[model samples]
Target: MSVERDILAKNDREANANRREFSRLGIFALNLVSSPGSGKTTLLVETIGRLGGELPITVIEGDQQTSNDAERIRATGAKAVQVNTGKGCHLDAHMVGHALERLAPAADSVVMIENVGNLVCPSAFDLGEAHKVVVLSVTEGEDKPLKYPDMFAAADLMILNKCDLLPHLAFDAALVEANARRVNPAIEILRLSATTGEGMDAWLAWIRGGAVEARRRRAAAAPRAQGCACAEAAAKA
Candidate 1:
């Protein structure tokens, strides 16, 4: 228990540093979490294709092996850094901070961190993202949220991907939403198919809204930051 607590404490400190750095740079970061085969990469590819022109976007791909996802992200001409976790099941805050240095995302831009495909470990590790967006495909059982309650409870929003497949599957979207709500009543839900482009506008709009707010926050903090710097300079004199 002590070891686990120590591990998380270190991660939290790193995460806070990352959050401050992101705010200072006016970067809106989103941590995308989900089980394997949740279509997270596909959604991200489509998202970048449509919204990258309007917003400066960079990607940090987290996986156990292979830079395949990062390659797909770069194919869209957006900057991407691949963090291969090797034996690790998740991307820790320290790893993401290093990746951010390499990504060098611009001010008022979005940094999409595609976490290693796992619901359990990623939920506990904070990557200093503005929000955690959990992706669940309709092909998965609705009881998923109930089984993986920690992930749903931790997420700010739950995205139901592969909605276009509803016609062919026995999956119950309503049940999944209900289960997710049971875990997190305040969690926002969005259903979309990355392949068919259905419901993407709403998702894109959400990203735009978040980016705007992130920019607003950075602008609001600038005066205080400058004042602190000036105070330090004066003290040195």
Candidate 2:
């Protein structure tokens, strides 16, 4: 237990440093967490397609073992890096930190990481992301938040994917949204079907929202940093 704690502590420190590095480079990172078959990849592809021309985007896909997701993203005409964590249940900040160095982003670029499909463990580690988007498919049942509270609780945004299949799957979109809000009052939820593109406008809008906000925040912050630097220089004089 002590050894495990030590490892986690080290990883946490590394994650914080990774956050600072990403911020300095002006990369808005987003970590996607979900269960297997929860449409993480599909959503990622759609996101890249939607935002491809709007902003420079790259992907880092985490899996226990598979180059499949990376290959899929590559097919979509976006740069992709695959992180295969053998036997690991989740991705930590350390893995993300190492991957970031390998795929350094230009200022104001986006790094979208699709975490290995599991709701629990990934929530424990922050990958220096602008936000953690949790994807829940209609096929996964409406009671998922009840089953996996931690992931739902940690997410900044909730994406209810596969809404095109809502009629077939009997997935209650209402209940899912309600329970998610119950668990995370602060979470913003969107319903979309990445497969048929139904309700995609909302998802695309949210992605654009982030990019726009990041650009705005960067624009807002630049003068403040510059002002501080000038003040410090004047003090030195």
Candidate 3:
């Protein structure tokens, strides 16, 4: 118990530092979490294609072994750095901080972090992101949220991906939303299919809204130069 607590304590400190850096740079970061085969990478590729022209976006891809997802992200011409967490099941805050340094995303840009395909460990690790967006495919069971309550409870938004396949599956969308809400009453939900582009506008809007607010907050929090020339200029006028 002591060891576990210490581990999380260290992670929390690092997460705080990462958060400060994100704020300073005006970066809106999203930690995407889900089980394997949840179509996170596909969604990202589609999203980048749609918004890359309008928004400056970078990616930090997390996986246990391969750089496959990172390659896909790079194909879209967006900057991406792959973090292969060999034996680790999740990307810790320290790892993400270093990745941020390597990526060096432009100020007032969006940083998409595709976390290791796991629902359990990633929920407990804070990667200094603005929000944790959990992706759940309709192929998965409707009770997934109930089973993985921790992930749902930790996420700020739950994206129901692969919605275009709803007619072919036995999945109950309402039940899944109910389960997710049971775990997190305040969790916002969006349904979309990365493959078909269905319901993607809402997801894109959500990202845009967050980026705007993050940039606004960063500007508001920025320190003004001491004895600034702007005040002096105003006084002269």
Q: Report, for every candidate in turn, its global Cα lDDT versus the true structure.
A: 0.95, 0.86, 0.94
Full-model lDDT, candidate 3: 0.94
**Which candidate number would show the highest lDDT if scored against the true structure?**
1
Ranking by lDDT: 1, 3, 2
In model 1, the worst 10-residue window by lDDT is 1-10
> Candidate 1, which segments miss by more than 4 Å at Cα?
1-7, 228-237
lDDT of 2 at 91: 86
Per-prediction TM-score, please?
0.94, 0.89, 0.93
Shift of residue 71 alpha carbon in model 1, Å: 0.3
**What's the best-to-worst order under TM-score?**
1, 3, 2
Query: 94-186 in candidate 2: lDDT tens per residue?
Result: 888888877776778788999999988999887778889999988887889988999999999999888888778766789999899889989
lDDT of 3 by residue, 1-237 (tens): 444457488899999998988888888999999999999999999999999999999999999998899999999999999999999999999999999889999999999999999989999999899999999999999999999999999999999999999999989999999999999999999999999999999999999999999899888776463347678888999
Candidate 1: residue 103 lDDT (0-100): 89
Cα RMSD (Å) between model 2 and the true structure?
A: 2.9
